[model samples]
Target: MARLSHTSLWMFMVFLFSSYCTAKTVTYDFNVTWVTANPDGLKERKVIGVNNQWPLPVIEVNRGDQLVVNMHNGLGDKNASIHFHGMYQNGTNEMDGPVMVTQCPVPPGATFTYNFTVNQNGTYWYHCHADYCYPDGYRQALIVHDNKSYFADQYEEEFTVTVSDWYHELIEGIAPDFLSVYNPTGAEPIPQSFLFNDTLNSNLKVKPNTTYLIRLINIGAFVAQYFYIEGHNFTIVEVDGVYTEPTEAEILYIAIAQRYAILLTTKNTTDTNYPIVTIADSVLLDKIPSDLKLNQTNWLEYNAEAPHPQADITVEVASDLNPHDDMTLIPHDHMPLLPDPDYTITLTVNMENLDNGASYALLNNISYTPAKVPTIFSVLSSGSLATNSLVYGEFTHPLVLNHNDVVEVILNNNDGGSHPFHLHGHTFQLLDRAPSYGPTFYDYKDGSPVSYDAFNHTAFPQYPMRRDTFVLPPQGYFVIRFVADNPGVWMFHCHIDWHLSQGLGLLFIESPQQMQERLTIPQNHLDVCRVGGIPTEGNAAANSVDYLDLKGQNAQVGWLPAGFTSGGIVALVFSVVSAVMGVAFLVVYGLSDLKFKGKGGGVVEGSQGEGAGKEVGSTTVREAYRDNGDEVR
Candidate 1:
């Protein structure tokens, strides 16, 4: 080597120092971009990919690998962000990936990078930060495998399966109460379809008899999905990225926010027509009819009356069940519940009178109203995308749980419409549904069950299915229980497109320590938390246009329109009217007494004087005067 010059030596030293002078870190990047164009021209769509693949091809790394992803905003005009559904990222708030909560929308052509270390192994997903009512725009799967020591047999092959639903509508700034008007015939704001890996008929073919690790994920906007191979059965060995006891799925029904790893073995190598896959419709077996009756022939409006009479669908399985075929394939594993539930909350998905002179959906009977927040400068403000038409309160609740606490949430859909309820972070076991009561639970004095479809009914069906999610049959109640083992903010919400937009959601926190460890901000990262955490239903904009100001002056108001109930307003009107009537009675009685007294002329005796003192007014005084008159005269 040539002799080094002093200047060259210093420059070399500087380069060395610069290369080694950094803290241990990594950066992650992503972008929310539209699909350029679809077969049908829907606007402002979201698509995902590192090079434009649906799941933005997996970011594979071993333990201790530094990670960095820079999220870019490429959606034409729609605002979007990314949420890593289940990631324990430490020391990274901005990268936490909540839209408008942790970070602002990656404005068109802007980029924000997320940096973290590969701390754990599991199958997780990231999607649009907007509510589940939105379609899977700019979403993908992120899988971190264990280092060599923890890796399972990988000599064969690896595959990924993503199951999700697609919507044909733009979800931004949609009102939450849209579900209330969900008549089957009514025009849907969002048309929905199912997609696998962002396309239909996505196939992965390989050698027969070879074991392939299939990672199945559901990134649907809402609702759990059932994925089945036309021919082969799968062994579900992992859930939410964690290895669990291997269970067999004759048919695979995956819940929202859930992931599963299955070992798929194709039967024959020579078979050219292998089922890459086929999607089954996830619609509820019980659908609401267009002509569902609201009133009976007798016209008695009963609260317990089912919104629609029952209709049935054929529950088809792949093969005819031999009498000896074990239907016991549906596992009955008791969830690992902690001690008794810490606190019990009963919330009903229902409809109550709204300020707009219409009946609206409710969570625990409270509809969406705006909260009283000072930072909010506008009256139409309900969420960040505040509007005059939107209700303030969406039907979401706040629950607190310990890391070890067990939670039993009973989602009773009393509304006439059906909904798919989804929980974040954990897959829950469905416990039971309260039996369908006729009209009222105890309305029958004669004790005859009310008759809509009297013939095809069970007093109460014992349906305790082990599922992470289930459909809410119309006019039905679904009780579910899950362990609060995950330690971050979790959201429970209706997957119905319009209902979620209207505000049908709530959040719960588990373990103060875990909460503090995971979420850096004291406030929750949802639309409800930004404005001081008040119930949205209390907003003034949601009040009716015809509402009168009775704050100061006493006024009697009456004859509320159909679909309206004002307990406080009714009480106020009744109080004012009742007081006026009381005063009128006193005045009339006083006037009559005065006339009777005037006619008497202050003299009294017996019947000879004033008809035997059978006086209408002052009878006692007249009798006293008559008896004393003799003595005084």
Candidate 2:
């Protein structure tokens, strides 16, 4: 009997420890509003910001923690949504936050809550998904710390460094000119300046002889930037939220939305301040205006008593770094070998001028348009993944995948410009790349297609590099593979802001049946679509002239007159009912608490409320509702 008692005690302790290791909730309240600021101290412009502060806010959390952000959109007349870039958002696809794909934009003067658990740890960021909003200022760093990281002990302190292309004109003002038919060259609006952490001449204080980890994030919209610090070398430890084998370099090339964590050791006894430089790559400068400055500088000062000398330093750019080489970024951890793919998707990316004379980026000859209804909503409501009349052809390219199925994607870039492709909700293995050089192009033009079978697929290291974003060289082909384990709708697209706006994107619908079972979208998310003046179909407004009837029949875009759809009415009614029920519950709970605390009454131990038998702590009421599987559909 004593032995059995000891066994029970051990089992009980194990259960308690396991439960404690589960995720806990971390909540943040964000007020999205407009602010006027000069990020470069040269031009004052109206910008969208969180809490009326420029550069927004940084979110830091440990791995296995639930992140809950309550966003109150106060941007007068503008809609907004925050997308947690590089987050897997496993099983919580409703909170993925790509407008019109996962959920609609949070309407102005409205509140929407995003909740998802962090399963992996590294550097990441959050940005506004609304068109041109992020470029204006709605972006911030999101860092997830991993105590068990391979390089955790290598650095004593950490800092976040953000580099972006700065524009003097408001993105709203530039959009019309950029999309105008008269501008047939498709030249992207060039940035006037560059910003390091929202400033031109930022300073980084460092301790001599100490090792510091700097998380470098390229949040620019258009061009790729090359970063280097004079008199120092970087040991790259992480890339795009995935840890990699340490590789040393004097300069690093960071594409749009890509991140790198590098270890920088201060000079042992030097009191000198080092210059940190950022310059736009010459290859990407073909479309940029010739007069715009391409380089920006900051200072990294080491703590010392004597004043440092004021001298400029010139360093060689890391032009020899090849993005196509997979050997450069070996994974630090052991990665399980991917099984033979169940599906192979070949996507050809190109640009073509439509009949209306507007240039659009296309994937597989189809320009992507945002769906009228959220793809997740459509999947759950219709109980199918088929491309129906409601889900327009150009709006969605559905690659329906089963759970745990391996998917290989071959991205064939036919355009003359490089594109940094980003895949939402998953990190893929980089298998190989074939550049469109002389011999490769010559064979293809001679009616001999370049075969991928000739490429050595096993040349990658034992644990290959896994990242969410990679640069697809102009007129090149890239191969990537990922397991379709995360359910719901995901977007695979170019990170170039202008190209993405021009419809360079596609959708992957992974395990819709599983998504229907796991996802419970909140009522507030559904209510965003019911807001006035928001388009449920296509990327344009209700009466916008940009809508095209591609079938050549000259038919109208929507069946009903604007704002008279039955679906909108049903959504409004449902939102109203949800609001009423929530209010009633709160009132009843408040009254019951008052009764319990009255002078003549005795408190009842079990009389809290319905579904309140267990103790509630940091979890909010809405989160509790979601936990109970109270879906809005």
Candidate 3:
């Protein structure tokens, strides 16, 4: 090989770039910074923006296109990263972003790149996965175009509709108060307003006699939404990036991180436009504000001149709406349920306060805590010992799985609320769920909770529906199964950002031996850890020499006393400490003699001794007040 001249090299590089672009290499240079946005028209607040654009940019790519995002952390005060939700990053698991799980949070002025191939196609999304990062307008719809879609030729056009709950304040400002001891029962912070397509009173202009593929995604932080169109019913085609057999549905209950694509044929006449309705799931809220608009209205505009009236909600509340039962759906591919699970992970979802008086969500008895080193680095650095869960630390809730094993997850909801759980790498089959959709679906909380018994349950579906995210009903149980074919560190956690912050999640270290063979941590990723003062090697405790030692790993806050609530414990401890210190300070002050301003020969040298005292209000070293109207206390 020989070096080319400057002019020749430049021309050659241009040719290569042109060829790459032609082959569908989609690239985005995102400058992650803060900007102001007012989606609800109520208040303008600071939000995370890409390329200085709020309501962030929607990323579109053809199936199999190599997507490359060169991200720079321009948010000077915050750390950030992006997670391509519903994407199965097969051989490229490092690109799956969840701070402390796959990679370190990109520090201020640092750079990180997300380069991976989009293999599957359907409704998906991308959002900042760093703790408290995405709620502030850092998320957007991600569509993968498939020329060979089953309904590709049946529909004339397609549109993406995102439903979300909006807040007037930044997440950082809300976390301290939301997670404080005063907020027991782990009540989630209620959003200020619900949005349609990131705005209010939006319209999806459509023509009569046209069938459009509408993509619905609930990119919300806390509350789930019920979606429907007045006087219209759509045929459901896909859910969470998995295509399902066409099933008619009049209403849908979409939880956070869930996506649904439906084929909706417009009415033959354009005489009237229909109202698209979205209602917040009030069951998830502890207290709904009187002015917070729960029912949001958009439009399926048949004629721009026609009046678009408000939707007539048939139900009194969101719970009264009967949405389709996802477990009863059949996969378009007809993929049957997986064989009996080779490994079964049975855990309960619990909400309780730790010794610190702050509430935390736990799986089994342990709440999730981020390790000192990223979990991905620990897998790549560990040798044969990667198969051993001991190296991953205790608080991380590490579950080392075998390669290509059939894994079954049985989630028992011990808490009194609903949780939408999502898995990072694979979509599992919805095997069985107790208390199916009907009048009693949302009424599960009124009675004792039902737990799934392996020996007893209804028959599993023949061709079970596959989805990346699913909702666990209130105090009800759900059983799901998936094959562990992908080799990487995938997280199994609740999609609620607030609950996740309280530690309601765990890591699935699948096929560690295979991960060690196929994956290599990128140099740029390593540099990010170094810049952030994070260790890239060692166990979760950052003990490199001895992988089994987890002595210093991060752990959840200690437990409160047996018979006291979080508030009671905090107040007791605070009062006791204050009284003891108050008495000690009183004794010391009482022993000292007072210096009167009239009898001042000079100031006493020390408060403990009676000596010559200086004059009061003097500007000398012994004076109690400064000459600039400042007291020395």
Candidate 4:
């Protein structure tokens, strides 16, 4: 009878826990405003709340619940919005809520409601959609806890470690002139100071004997920055917004745009104050020779604070999980995952037109050229070559990686500037780097020697790191790998505001199905183009023989039907012109040198000997184009 009673009680408790896990309907309100209190004041002063408090209040909810968040803008000057990162929910596109992406900004005295569901269960965050120039105080943390039964015995306390960077400029409204700002030829350095949860100087206190889960997020700009608990080692169990096979480290370097959830149990140490966390600022081109000097215009000094070799915080050890003990915590099983393909495309950073009046840096061979018109019109218009033609140097267009392909990218920075290149929708592994760089295989290029340069390797014990966004240091490159398992038209671009506006971006389409589902080419978006099918006659009706061919044919360059007169064709024409001009000039110069040099005659002088010589060379170019059936411009 007692056994039966115990079974009944167990079933009843399970039912109650399941009910709690499945509860629905959660609503939250976030208000935005400006305050004028002096934080540096020595005396007590009243500090006004932008919403209703500082550091904002915590948001708590459970999985599988409807979430409706209303944002009120009281910040008299600018628009406002909120974005919940890494959450899956209905109305994802609508709820993406970036100020200009899906909805308009909330002007002063206005309010906006973001409605969605929390279908994902894990640690995630919510922050203002303002430009990167905004202050750190504007962002906050959010927790969607698992029902107690889910981790009834595993979880004890949750500690949110929201890392941030600080900038004195107005980050949000600094755009519209982004082109001017990120003009590769510009003179300004990107911002440098960083913080933890809006505090330039604050720390998290903990007792020695407890196991604490630390949710680490880099809502900042630098990539490959290492965070270390100097006297302690911990295990990393989750990356990005998902769980991972546990990895351990004392020093951890994270690529920009990534999140890691680490579990650390502190152990007691002697009464001496030991360093808990130390951050080492990364320097681009770390392997460069000390005496080497690139042109002043081609290299910039690393401006972040000197690496924090000294731990920033120290506290007394209180429990069995002491600062002195080494620990290992691995998840029981690996998460189920899909397979991917293997192909890598490298984005090399280099400079051109050296010493020329208008020299600029190039990714591949494509220069950063911002659209003269607004992005909205660029999205809608057909005549703008800048918007329609997706160019990646001399390489192929619309880089199509098949679904399930193991894709890797090497962002090689040859110029002096550092760029935080961000990929949308997915996170990637740092893999291994060139032997002369750092440690760990989390980041790597195609085939660097497995073993070399052990001296510098030991310095960064936390590498190769896992990250979503990583910076390409000046004249250096970062290799990142990931499975191209997600299907979509994902945007891969530099996170630097100006660089992105200036065309340092490209789209990576995963599959044909994904391509068709996501793409709305210039021709497809216009009514006239859709009606005519193509500019050519005789292929435009249901009964026409030509129409049947069009219908039956697989979509390819040949199936394009050749008569569209929008941006695509115009871009092709420009490309052709550029190519022909280049070849003509080269041939003319080559032949002239061959004739004048006479085995050893000076080729340079011969090509410029007389006006007639120059004119003859020009005439050859014109004749060459005429023979190719093209008119010389």
Candidate 5:
């Protein structure tokens, strides 16, 4: 009888503990609109805001809680959608936002809700995923608190630091220059200033001898930044929502859409404060203006009375500062390298002019183009043909995957610029990359690209790192692997907003049959599509009768005629006409001498020379067109 009473007491204690830790639902109602704010103190411009406020609210939730964000697009002039970056939306793919990838963009005055279970925990962010929308300040940090973290007991408190690039003009004004022939090289617009936590020179008051967890996120649309703190080093514990084994680092290179969590223990003395420096990567700029400040300084205040000195300049350029290679970090779970992939997909990144003569990024030969129907809807409504990649449209670059198959992707860059590639719905195991961060990172910048030789390359690590976003070296290659366990359409794209605009992206239709069986999109999402005049049924072109027939599907801008763009063609035509007209004038002048000589009955010696001059002019005109033709062709 006594033993039975002890067992009942133990069971009662377990039940009380579980009841206390029960997860609750977190809900937020957002009214998205336009507001004005000057974060960098350089200029005030229109920025996207939530609830009539500019610095959008940071979303906070604990792991295992339910997150529901009821978003109403109050911006009468623009469309918007929120993408919870780095979240693996597992079975809820319809809520994975990317304009037309998962759901339609919420139209003006329309309401849409993103409701999902918070199963993962770490530092993350939520931002507008629609084209040219997030850059206008529709981003905020989304933190998922994990009481069960290995390092949770190490820190007394936590802080969120956001590094971003600020622009004086809105995305609408900047889009014309980036997507037009006037800026022929597709040079990304230079930001007016760099921002630290949505403002400038802000101080974080810290108590000496206290350990704090600092979450670093580059919430910018274009430029990445180098982050460091003077007189202190921190241990990195998490990256892109994945808890990694604690590693020590003094400097970190944070690209756009990337996040890192570090444990920073303050010094015992409160005699002085330290400067936290953020340097914009200058290599991304086409032209850095003299007045445009690239380096920004914030403070870690140990004492309010102590002077906060400016940071000491250490490097000649941002590239000279070598950051720790993130590919080497091991995950806390220590998930081993996935076995030889059941499938492999290989492609190259090329920056070339399309038929419009505007520069575009391409995977293989196709640039990502949107479809009339959201891809997730297509998968749900396509019946048994959902697994067919053809239904997703040619320019969407659809690749189908079977359920539970291990997939490998090889990405080779032919361009000289680096790209931070992000895959939605999964954290891929980064197996191998060439020309890693260090002195030899840029050795292939001007030379032939080093492609990943599957059979001849370095051996894969026993325990490879995993992250949703990974940086691809310029003119180098990277190989990653992941299991296609999720059943939905996921987009794999470059996180650089400009690159995505130029069509540097693709779609993966994973286990579409399962999606058709298990997925049911909300009716409100369908209503928004109707309001936007977007069809939600059938294939990409909206042919519900035949899923395989994609006749009217959206396609990318056609290829330029080998070395010649439409702009070049027009210029050539105008030059040719101008040359012909000039030749005609010379010929007319050459005959002037003969006409006068016949009328006056007087011989002119220069008539022969004038005739020769006409011949020379004719030859010059023909040669000019010929030379231009050669160059254009």
Candidate 6:
């Protein structure tokens, strides 16, 4: 019996230890402020920073842990909000943090607390969702580690490498001109330089003959980049926070908001430094002007060695690699093949020239505009579909969905330029793609030089690649599928800053009824709208009409009383004054009676018993006073 008791005690202790290790809480207190620093070699400009540090701060957590961030905004007059890119946010939709979509922007001198659970483990990032804020240096890497990672034993150490396209002028200085009506060419503002981890020439030092896991994140606002290192090859193990089958590549093509985990092994040769090159794809560039550099070079050194000769290295672009190829990416774990979709939506994407000559992007002939009140707030408060129409404009497209429905979306890119599309709150499975553009320039619209009858819906693999961001090539179409399980108002849009500002997006209203029951928005989120200078409106540049008409209809009233005259108006004023005085005198008399009664006066107390006697006396006095006044008049 004693031996059995000891065994039971050991089991109980083991259970407690396991539970304690599996669940933990991670918290961070961050202050968002402004600083002037030159990330590129160009001139210094004002940029937003977290904890007064540039490039923000990296957040690392373990799976099944709770992450709580207390963020205070101090960017003078700018409003800001942080979005955890690629996070499933699960039951915490308010913390998803897209300005004017999920909640209001955190105004200057305000604080917001983002608390959510880290259910999935992989690479992710966080950035400001406010217009042009992320491009102005409000971003950081977010890594969630898992004890059962697919390649846990493959590498000894890990490092995060961020690449971006930098500009000389701030977004505010460039947006107005680039989106002006007079700018008919629709030329996007070109970037002036490229950066590696917010530095002009960043170096990744390593030991010889060792394998390192590099987390590559493309946090750029506009261009997609091709990254590679001289004399080294890497194997990609993860993409957009999902583990994938290992695929070897010489160069990686990463789009904005996309992330990849690659294994890099140093050579056994003598210690030397190699060049890490990142070049902006000129295919996405629209009419590049002279004097702009596209290629950026950093260093990968071994044991603090000197840089090797440039002639010994050769740079290559990975444009030839097809992202939709079957062997490129497969699910690390087995995923069941999806059946026929419960909902299928076909969206048409194109550019339209407004009457005012300003360019705007459209989805199904309608441009999305943010409502005065947040959609989440409106839905929760009212639980009405009509609320969506009232808050969002009439033109805002809402893909209403029910819970657990398999949804398939066909994105037809009817534009002349490539767009990097990103979906919030969930990662979707890429089904298939069909390209229409080639050596011959194909028109974007139907009945043109191209025919889309050959859509490749049957060509998808058993387990498709899942990601949050993918390139929608010009004059091409792609299909993606996802289950409508996460309930919220999610924004699906192009990642290009200029294009998003021009309204190339739509809202996916998933399980509105369920969202109302599950979402609990704090008073702090509602308070953001009451604060001054915080933007509550959606992208206004996308509107076809720039101004609103506030005039009301006029009414006419022609007839009046026949005897009305100026002298009659004077007599009417005198009667009104007499009536007002009579009421005031009665009120004073009643208050005095109440005061006398309180002091035990017999006159007021006796009147309560003889009400008729008191009325007779007051009536006689009123009659006498009226007769005297009439005689004086």
Top TM-score prediction, candidate number: 5
- With candidate 3 superimposed using the best TM-score fit, by how many Å does residue 199's alpha carbon deviate from the native? 0.6
Query: Tens digits of per-residue lDDT for model 2 on 112-160?
Result: 9998888888999999887877888888799998877877888899999
Better of 5 and 6 by TM-score: 5
Question: Which residue window of length 10 is worst by lDDT in model 6?
Answer: 549-558
lDDT of 6 by residue, 1-633 (tens): 445588898999997888678888899988999888887656888888888888788999998889999989988778899999999888899999888778888888988889999889788999998877888888889999876887889898899988888887778877776654434345677887778888867678887788899999988888888778888888888888888888887767787888999899998865678888777777677655577766777777774557553423233433433332322478788574577899998888877655444567788877666655565665565445422433344444667778999998888877767787899988888777655222222234233312134343456668888889877767777788899999988989998878887778888878878887888877677676667443333222112122132122111112225664434433453454456446545644564455244455544543355453444345533432221022112
Q: Over the stretch 1-633, how does candidate 1's per-residue lDDT look in tens digits? A: 798899999999997775456323455555555553342233335544343534465666555567776666565565556666656553444355544224434445555565666555667777666544236455567786653422266326677767665555445423322322212211233334556666543346566566777887876655445555545676765665455445666555455556767777766544333333433333331332343221111101112222322212124521111111111223333334334465555777754434432234567655432223211211212232232212222222335566667777767665544466766555665455433221221223233222223234333213233433345645656666767776644556665544555556665544435444444332222232333232222232223232121122211112246644545434443454456445545644554444322355753323344433234333433222211011111
TM per candidate: 0.56, 0.78, 0.87, 0.55, 0.88, 0.78
Candidate scoring better on TM-score of 2 and 3: 3
Q: Which lDDT tens digits does candidate 4 get at residues 33-93?
A: 6653333222222222456566666566786677888777767666566767555332244
| Model 5 misplaced regions, further than 4 Å | 1-21, 565-633
Positional deviation of residue 539's Cα in model 6 after best superposition, in angstroms: 18
Q: Which stretches of model 6 miss by more than 4 angstroms?
A: 1-20, 311-327, 384-392, 436-458, 532-633
Error of 1 at 433 (Å): 6.4
lDDT of 3 by residue, 1-633 (tens): 999999999999998886567557899999999999888899999999988988888999987789999999999999999999999999998999999999999999999999998888999999999989888888999999887888889899999999998889899977876776545556677889999988999999999999999999999898999899998899999999888889999989899999999999999998999999999989888887789989988999999999989988767878887889888889999997789899999989988888766789999988999999999999988788899999998988999899999999999987788889999999999998766664567677877788999888999988989999988888899999999999999999999999999999999999998898998778999999999999998999999899988898898988876898756755664464456445545644554555433355766434535332322212332232121112232
Question: For candidate 5, which ten residues in a row score worst on lDDT?
Answer: 624-633
Candidate 2's displacement at residue 545, Å, is 28
The candidate, 1 or 4, that scores higher on TM-score is 1
Scored against the true structure, residue 108 in model 6 reaches a CA lDDT of: 86
**Number of colliding residue pairs in model 6:** 0
lDDT winner between candidates 2 and 3: 3
lDDT for model 5? 0.88
Better of 2 and 6 by lDDT: 2
Candidates sorted on lDDT, descending: 5, 3, 2, 6, 4, 1
lDDT of each: 0.47, 0.73, 0.87, 0.47, 0.88, 0.72
